[model samples]
Target: MNVEHGVHDAPYFVPSPSRWPIVGAVALFFFALGAALTVNKVAAGWYSLAGGLAILFWMLFGWFGDVIRESQQQQYGQQVDWSLRWGMSWFIFSEVMFFAAFFGALFYARSIAIPELGGDTLTRQLLWPDSQAAWPGNSAPTSTSYTPMGALGIPAINTAILLTSGATLTWAHWGLVRGRRLQLICGLVATIYLAALFLALQAYEYHHGFLDLNLTLASGAYGATFYLLTGFHGLHVFVGTLMLCVMLARASQGHFSEKQHFGFEAAAWYWHFVDVVWLLLFVVVYWL
Candidate 1:
């Protein structure tokens, strides 16, 4: 291997300064303690969860702000950049596995459990009526049968919005490549807006589910699975949106150039992954 990749991004060595970690740790302690207590509400579980969340956010702001400053000051080395990439890649991989587990559970429930429980003929006949194991709208009792959302309605619109945002982000990337700062800024703005819009539409859809269709997490096995799949995906979307906002902030500050925009690349990868997951959920959980 090449002995060195030029003058790396970060400094060779610096003073071990700052007590951020200790403060972050203390903040986390409050957050965790608050969360645990808040769970018991009357015992303060709710307050604990709230306080912990606040502390967690505080830590993130201070911690990431410090890293951003270091990165911007050119204290980061190519090695540091590579490390960030690998860490993000591994995190995304873990997220994939997490979703895979949920999807697997969904598949088993739809394909195996429901079918076996509602089968007919001989012993099957003793099970229930000659029922077919359906995905959402299974032939189970009304109380347990869960109906998926319609694909053409809000979900399809959300999908389109996300895709369009992805395209805009690509344009922003190109603008960065060509060093068109103003155009890049516009692209980032558009992407962020589109992401926010997608989130709003999803919220609306969830409201419709609860108020109009009476479908909810408490509906039974079907309801439970539906929420488990869609809820987590929605949370991911929210997270991806925040990442895009960060990229936008960095872009506006002229942090990236055509050659050193891996941060943007990683965020885009995550957003695209979020989009793909939503599609799968729409089809398997909604349309299917």
Candidate 2:
């Protein structure tokens, strides 16, 4: 039996003896241990969490860099591209399901739990009469106070910025397909810069929310869920921005050409996906 990178005809040229799996598993183990201990007031848990985060970040950097290097070497074929596209599609699908769960939870809280708890129902009248039934941003239960992040201000500006970045990335993809190296490089650079700006602005927004608006994750269930969802999405945006930045770096190094540029395409796909998701999030989570 022919064996290449542990299996013949495997997706992409996964280098032999990949260590990311072991690294990831060990990091996860530490993360769990730290989480458990932290909940129990153990002093060493914070150190464990820090170590796990460091290891996880290191693993991601190394593993993704290796993949980027391999792709630039043109060891991947059409079959490999197909496999990658499929993988991305499925990954996005899983993300959709993840967000769907949160949306479902939101619906349950607003449509059922809150109303019932506020004595809108026959059985809950005696239990939680002091609670208020309201949508998250407008008004929430009495447990916490927070201001809703509206879409008319910075959120709208961020939407425009992300949309523009998406457009520039599309232009870059066009340049790649048409064999315009300068155009491709310019477009990639613009997109990367915009992404960075978006992240910086987001951080500023978070600071404003905390310092001025008193919006915090610990404020209430609304604040908790809002931060959990938007915070995770922001983390993804940060990651996507980093991916684009690396693509820009590779573009500058003349690593990708018109004919062979799957790495560029993959980053574009991921960024576009992030932009679309942000649009929805802005409308649903921030605006409405």
Q: Pick the candidate with the highest TM-score.
A: 1
Candidate 2: list runs displaced more than 4 Å.
1-15, 137-145
Per-residue lDDT of model 2, residues 33-117, tens digit only: 9999999999999999989999999999999888877777677866677788899889878877887888777667667777766
Q: Which ten residues in a row have the lowest lDDT in candidate 1?
A: 1-10
lDDT of each: 0.78, 0.79
Q: Estimate, for each residue in 52-123, the C-alpha lDDT of model 1 and write its tens digit.
A: 677778778877787777767666666767888999899899999999999898888788877786665454
Q: Candidate 1 versus the native: TM-score?
A: 0.86
TM-scores vs. true structure, each candidate: 0.86, 0.85
Local lDDT at 73 for model 1: 69
Clashing pairs in 2: none
Best by lDDT: 2
lDDT of 1: 0.78
